[model samples]
Target: MIRLLACGALATVQDRGRLGALRWGVGTAGAMDTLALAGGNLLVGNPDDAAGIEIQVPPFEIRFEVATTFAVTGADCALMLDGVPILPWTGARARAGAVLRLARRASPQAWGARSYLCVSGGIDVPVVLGSRATQLRGAIGGHQGRSLQAGDELPLGSPDLSPPVAGTGLVPPVVALPLAVDGLPALRVLPAAEYECYRPVSRAAFWGEPWRVTPQSDRYGFRLSGPTLTPLEPLELRSHGIVPGTIQVPHGGQPIVQMCDAQPSGGYPKIGTVIEADLWRLAQAPIGARIRFIETDWDGALAARDALDGWLSAARRALSYLRARSTA
Candidate 1:
């Protein structure tokens, strides 16, 4: 068990998110940076989809009620265990009553917005609709189906007796599998159903210009500030099913990228959809950050997904080998 000493406003318990719940209009409210969650889980010897804490608004502090192994990943931040600095992406053992705190990045230029804290046994949140991920909209999953607060005590699953060796870590996915455009982070986008409705210039601008993530962005969607994307003709579409990564251009001409907590259906026209493989990159893009969108096709999207799978597979194998050597 672990107790939250100070949990910022947006921190929540999440796993890989609820699958098949979209049919019931429940959005997947998983970790914003899933690669980070998976990496942290690997370090702590948990399954890839194990539940963990997604720390968005940081300065989060927690105390272990029992001795346990844990790891922190995602945004590069100042992590301290009992006031001693612990490196990001690295796993370490914490004796009972040890306090762990995470703060803003020491370096101003470090790129990332969210972080993941994974333990040897996952956070023992009850499964709802086949997932332990927090569904803040419906208020059905996670701890009370709301953001964590100070003094909240969370349970943990039974952990492996032979835990992975402390200090094991992985090269963050951002560094290991980089994707950028003109020196800026980028997300590959495939043109959507309404792509052709936009004027030629609008289409050109969408591909060529950098879009700034506005302050209005949140778990529901990223409201982007960029070139006004005027359509060739005014469009009015009926509400239709959408998913995370759908880029909707509203009446204001600004694009809104649906995120993990977005509604299942939307009425706005969609210009493009960021591929699933690059959602993690966009998830880490901080407010006021400018990012580019690389135009891609179905084949390119599939290829990118495959690359991400390969990276995870390799990490799993490498961690398994390390655990074997440590126990040998």
Candidate 2:
């Protein structure tokens, strides 16, 4: 078990996400940086979809009740264990009563919005529906179906495999992952059903210009501030099924990209949908950061998805090989 010593209201238990429930009006709310969660899980030999703690606000701390192996991934926060510095995106062992601290990111370049903390086993949370992910809107899953608070005691699942050595770690192969631009991390978007309803200029700007994520954004949606995306005419659309990454333009012309915690359906005009492969970038993108949209075809989107899958497969194999050599 681990105890939340300092962090409260900024962290929650999450898994891959509750999928296949959207048909029943449930939104899929999970870790914003799923790749980081998956990477952290793989580091500790947990299944890719295993439950872990999702840390959004930083300067967080936790104490281990029992000695165990753990990994910290996502934002490059300056992490320390009992005052000894530890590397981000790496796994390590801690003794009983060891206090783990994650300070505010030391470098401006490393200040991502979220991070993942994975233990040797995983966060032992009851699985609601088909996932352990928290659906904040419905308030029906995760740790007590709400954000964690100070003094919260979370149970740890029993490890399925041997724990890594105290210093065992792996550097994330983020370079091999998909990105829009070199450092800007462009998100590939596919035209939605109402794509053609917008003016030609609005459509062009949507693809060509950079949009800044507004402060109004949250887990449910990102209200982007950019060139007004005016529809050719006033569009009164009926409520229809919407998924994560769905970019909807309301009457105000600001494009709001629905995220993991978004409602199952919406009535706004959707000019495009950001491909799933690049949603992590958006998740990590800090407020006021500018991001570009790369218009892509269906084939390109599928290829991108394949690329992500390939990366995950290769990463798992590499970790397995390393573990074998280490054990030998």
Candidates' C-alpha lDDT = 0.91, 0.85
Ten contiguous residues with the weakest lDDT in model 1: 159-168
Q: For model 2, name the residue pairs that clash.
A: 180-186
lDDT of 2: 0.85
lDDT for position 118 in model 1: 93
Question: What does each candidate score in C-alpha RMSD?
Answer: 1.0, 1.5
lDDT of 2 by residue, 120-161 (tens): 889988999899998877687898899988888999999887
Evaluated against the true structure, the overall lDDT of model 1 is 0.91
Error of 1 at 320 (Å): 0.2
Runs off by more than 4 Å, candidate 1: none
